[model samples]
Target: MKEICIVEFPSNLGLKEPQPGKEPGVKKLPDWLWKHNLHKAISHNILRLDPPKYSNSKDVETQILNANSLVEYAREQAYLINNLLTQNKFPFILGGDCSILLGTAIALKQKGNYGLFYLDGHTDFMNISLSETGGVGGMAASIVTGNGHEKLTNILNLSPYIKEENLWCVGNREYDDEYENEIRNSSATYLSLHELRKQGISNSVKSFLQEVETKNLDGFWLHIDVDVLNDSIMPCVDSRTPDGLTYNEFNELTSYLFQGNKLSGLEITILDPDLDTTGEYTKNFVTNLTSTFNTFKNTIN
Candidate 1:
């Protein structure tokens, strides 16, 4: 375990404009979490990688919105993350959107072979044609796994930031056949919400860890999309669905993952404060996350 570095990537450039003239509020996620004191018990070392200006127009070349800017931001982000890794700091990144995984993935690839623990409501394994809004955030899993346009899939000449076999896509509640097939057809392991419950949360986590050790991977990264929580509990995210992981389930899963420290770091993404008109959702989120995080605080300190 090492000291934690809280990196704020407040960029909504990866999502489509929710409204005609309005941008997604995901960029405010880090601040909202901070406003609720998510950092109170967590580390105080914070860094902000502000994104380039957000745009509504999709790139004609890639047909993904803000493709060029996203690549640029990811490179800068990798620079910061590289520094944190060099300092032996565990990066607890607060993201603007799931697409932030691009930067994190690139950063990890620079070091060595790493695995990905993708926890999200949707598979996010979409390509431009499959994405209705052309939001890169929606295709995060695909890009990181080198399944999308070369521009995003290839960063620093490190295509496939994470090898498919070393990846685990979990907590997907979206029942889209095409989306599910994207990851399912790949070598990456997929565990839908239903499958996770059926097999038991702890069992699912243990299985992933077993694979991590088996591969002798340098380390692995955790990407958590708040939408993985039950819609009844976490409805502030852009894509809301029905039943998902409960608070207790989330805590139990993370507690297991954080044990023994093979994990490189973790990131939280796609929680929209605008949708949570009342801060209740954000507050509850902060409470649960910080509580879970604090359990491992001593090891890092």
Candidate 2:
């Protein structure tokens, strides 16, 4: 079987404090997944990228929390992922938050034109002016698409890591009629949770893959935020919404995405271990996800 390297990226530098003095617990994600046997159930080749100190202070210049640190982290992350790709190993990244997308964006941009399959509960397409919180986590989609502050959008002098037309923002259920206009008006394809259900999960992924083929792009990246799961099943994330895809639908989506040849790598993000004190939700997540990944690997072999 071809290798799939599990990368542990535990950086919470992109989010604001959920309360007065507590940092986000998303940094504990890798450890939590490991305890649940995520590694044992899959490939044992794992690499970890230690994140900088978590800071809640927003940057004066960029107006986003830990913007400078995020930039530095992005470069480091890109270097690691680039190395993995060179070795023909598929990188399965475990993220600290949605902010990790910036690093993957940089790595993919360096290679060639790439598309993005963004699965999240919220658009996360907020810019500095539209964001109520100065969290870069909220602005990741905007930054990667070159719509935010230049420092983040232009990491390593490469701006717009992923082109707007190449992105497909899916599974978003945060139906803010006002704030959602930004993405709705953008060139990137938008498929809300309801629309996805109506279009059929398999059909949605097929359409995205068809676009990748139509563009004749090198490949694409997959970003899965756990909050994309229905809130009842996945409320551990810092940001939550009332609606999302179910585990069955999520499994089908993964199966179809994995069937495609153009998927370069994938990142799983925004699952908080702190909230699942009993570890029930994490175990359920690990079981469902690992099964999907293993099934895909078996098929490829």
Candidate 3:
């Protein structure tokens, strides 16, 4: 398989802190993954970016904490991604939260129009008014599609970081009633967890890829928020939900996604090591991720 570049992003500004000492668990993700040797498993040419310091303060206008900071960080991330792409390197971005999607989307937009393969537990379509906690991570999808606050929607003078029809949301289980109309009206295609289970992951993914092919996209970004996995097996996520895919099911899905080499880049987000006191979950995550990369190597080469 081709070698790839790993980018480390360890910021937690997107989520709100519920308590004084209880910060978001994402800040430690990059180090945790490194300590466990994610770089060794994936590639040797790892480019570690210095993430902005964690900021929990909220924006006065948007009411989302670290709204401005996210934009700044995204711009920096865009520059780094642009450089990597220019050098013809595949970036495997290790993210702090789902909100990092903004930076990735912007970087892809800068190069050309690309599609998005979003795998997450929540739809992340909530607008500022609809988000109960005003977490930017919750509205990342909306922001990328030009449906959220103007400040976030228009980053680096790029409006609509990703086109709606080029986006495909998969493995989603959580839905907000208040924003149900907004989500339903979106042009982006969605394959809910129920639908995926009914169709089976392999078939469902094939269908999604076919749709993406019809769009004639430049390339597509694969975003995987670990919360999409079943809470029983993957319990380190901040937004823990029940009844997600098993390790075998997710591995099968990943193998299929990486086989064809249609992906421009990939991002893995939302694994909080703080919650996993025993470190068993991290070990499991490392094993599964390493196995998936190995599958990609065998299939793509």
Per-prediction TM-score, please?
0.98, 0.98, 0.95
Each prediction's Cα lDDT score? Answer: 0.89, 0.89, 0.82
Instruction: Please give the distance, in angstroms, between residue 66's alpha carbon in candidate 3 and its true position after superposition.
Output: 0.3
RMSD (Cα, Å) of candidate 3? 1.7
Candidate 2 minimal-lDDT segment of 10 residues: 292-301
lDDT, candidate 3, 1-301, per-residue tens: 4458898888777887846768888878878988888878888887776666666777887788788888898999899998887776788889788888888899889988888888888878777887777788888888898887788889888988899877778888875555556666788887778878888988878877786677677778889999999999888888888799889888888877887566778898888888877778888888997878766664442
| Residue pairs clashing, model 3 | none
lDDT for model 1: 0.89
How far residue 49's Cα lies from its native spot in candidate 3, in Å, is 2.1
**Candidate achieving the largest lDDT:** 1
Residues 1-301 of candidate 2: C-alpha lDDT, one tens digit per residue: 4588899999888888889899999999999999999989877899999888888888999778888899899999999998887787788899899999999899999988999999988888887998877988887888899998798999888898999999899988988887789899999999999999999897889999999999999888889999999899998999877978899999999888877787888898999998999999999999999898887774431
Q: Give the total clashing residue pairs for model 2.
A: 0
- Greater TM-score among 1 and 3 belongs to 1
